[model samples]
Target: MKKILFIYFAIISLVLPQSQNESGYAFLKNGFTARNIAMGEFGAVGINDLSALHYNPSYLALNNKTQLAFSHHSLFNDYSSENFGFSFNLFNLPFAIGINTTKIDGIELRTKPGELIAKFNANYFYASLSSAYQIKNFYFGATIKYLYENIYIDDSNGYAFDFGFNYEKFYDNFSLGVVIKNIGNVNELKNIKTKLPLDFQIGINYNYKYDDFEFNPIIGYQNYLTDKISHLHFGTEIKYSQTVSLRLGYVSNYDSKNITTGLGVVFKKFNIDYAYVPIKYGLGDNHILTLIYNF
Candidate 1:
């Protein structure tokens, strides 16, 4: 038992971030869509949905249909985000594009009691171009992004890159994936400079089939360069037929809510998904709604 504990701690020590405030653009760490958020943000691998543009671009190689996806995230403290993504295949290769914007409003700016001054808002925008190719059982992918952030009258912009790879044997029901994200930093507020929330993640997925029911389970680990903690994520989805699914997920080494659940419904080429997450400490809960169209 002692030996196992030591090994676990050693792995954590190697993966955890060195400091909490070491990076900027923290919002980039937020999950992309309702389905991913429902899966406890275990997006390092699996399923290869359109949202893979934000997680593991290598999964793009698995795309068999063109898709467009949109998501709305309702967060606490008057903050919210809107995400849009599209994935398609051209010349036997897959490409994905996405944009995300987060905003916070309703601030009370006052210079004196009972006196209202001016209200201000902050916004963050991210745009990305991603593509993936496969050679036999190995898949490779890359993404390039431009990030812009503004607060009041001040704004800044930067660029970043992500690289990913996936390996699967044609006859196997399991796959492994790895990715490195946010390979660049940002310069904000003229004199303030900070690093992006760089992360390294690795994960695997297993698929089990029992008659007409299908089950997918995923396990992953993520290391952030900006904090002193590592994340362990687990996700599972049970599917009945071609139109319905239930998803459950859990995340360890988190400061807020760690469990997530979601529902998915598909009709023809359209899909709808919803996720419910209860925040800890009564801060507030989060609700994510997503719609996907496949062609």
Candidate 2:
């Protein structure tokens, strides 16, 4: 099984950018879903979908339903990101997988008229496999990922790992979650060696339920091993009739953004989400859309 996974990962890696403008694999920092992005990337708790493969793997065990999720990012029309995720159960244990691809388009070289080398394309790709198991009130999980990038004619490849744990007791309204990500540098560009951005995060959330409405308040802290920087994230979600939700989030210590908001709608087993984020430094704003199906 492991061998098959590695082979599949390799094939996917052949096909696949940045926030904070630092770190070797900065594209990995991009959120995979509008729901998560609107929630300040807070995934320490209250998450139970295939997107968990991009955040806290332990969340996979929270649900047994098979799920498929996809998202698209419109970043000022300069670049775009697409993400796809799937999760299911095997032996009563939950497993999840995902892929992300980012493409930057439209560039012109200063040429007299028309030059064959006037424009080029750049891309980034990520593929991850994750699984989680539960013991009593604790859930533990891990994910292995393959990272690849192509810039003009140069390309690079790398590997990383994510570990996560969640604690949720039955009949409890609160949960705690923790994750360690980008642990190893399996490979990199031959010319210039690089390292993944190692991160450690812990989050907690409390759910308040009454009648058919629900509200969740979340907070999280993230520390970076490579840059020695830390960030605080805050978010809230309000659900009505278990079909509609409104989300708001705030993040501290950022270069070009701080606040995010989103809306979500559920129909039977289908979920649709949208988020709006304003970019600082006059970069305009970002609009993200996500779709999910559970069966």
Candidate 3:
């Protein structure tokens, strides 16, 4: 059973989403919030969103209120993820924390084509602590993360870091951001070490207002160091009265999925967001929902 489980995990580590079979811990590449997902997973150049703790921590410097956020992501093949985020201030400095837990269940163990011997589950988790400092209109931030993964009876632990910079003084309606992410290493899992997905990303965005509606368009470039691949992210959002938003996004250079759409609603101190992505090859679809409250 252990040997089979090891083989299963080896295969899984190679085929997880967004990494193109080149790196492990692919779950780290997923979007942190539904709004971000709806906007093509644009992590940089965020505006006061606590989810920045996962993408570009430098954006956390924009936070002036205490906020809490929760999200659930449903993927194909009985895979799911739960996430939590919190942001607050201490001594006039902004800080945020994030947690993610993912599970893949009902994995079958069979010795023959028509026979099933047993079923098991695989789990992954990561926790992060982040903080940002602002100097004039420039923000700098860093994040430290602890990662863990369990497959049947074998488990490994790891650590990583993310650093980010944001320039918001260029214009009132424009912002630019850059980040370096997943800089660390993981322990060996069954005598084989898994490689982290190291990445560098840069993004720009513009906000425009007309009458009672506002428009935001964003573009980003991402480079995966390990996979030697590059991708482009594009997204736009239209908001009415600052209460309701319609979002559309597209990500280039993916084999399984690309286009995404979603919406957001703001009610007093609470916000609700949803995102949907249709996968190809009959692999079902991806759905994400997030709720946030500010105090």
Q: Clashes in each model (backbone N, CA, C under 3 Å)? A: 1, 1, 0
Tell me the TM-score of model 2.
0.87
Give the number of the best model, judged by TM-score. 3
lDDT of 2 by residue, 1-295 (tens): 0111122223233232123333676677788899888988677667856788988998888765598988999876567899999898888788888999998675443324444334555688989999998888899989999988876566788788999998985457888999999887735453555657788999888889999999988899998777677999999889999899999999999998999999999988899999999997766588999999987
Per-residue alpha-carbon lDDT of model 3 for 1-295, expressed as tens digits? 1224334645455434334447878788888889889888777775558988998999888665579999999987588999999999998888898999998777776655665668888789999999999998899999999999987677888899999999984888788999999999888776666788898999998988999999989999999887788999999899999999999999999999899899999999999999999899877799999999988
Model 3 poorest ten-residue lDDT run: 1-10
Alpha carbon lDDT at 150, candidate 3: 84
Clashing pairs in 2: 16-125
RMSD values, in order shown: 8.7, 7.6, 3.0
Tell me the TM-score of each prediction against the true structure.
Answer: 0.89, 0.87, 0.93
Residue runs of model 2 more than 4 Å from their true location after superposition? 1-22, 108-117, 170-172
Cα deviation in Å at residue 68, candidate 3? 0.6
lDDT to native, each model: 0.80, 0.80, 0.85
Candidate that scores best on lDDT: 3
Local error of candidate 1 at residue 8 (angstroms)? 43
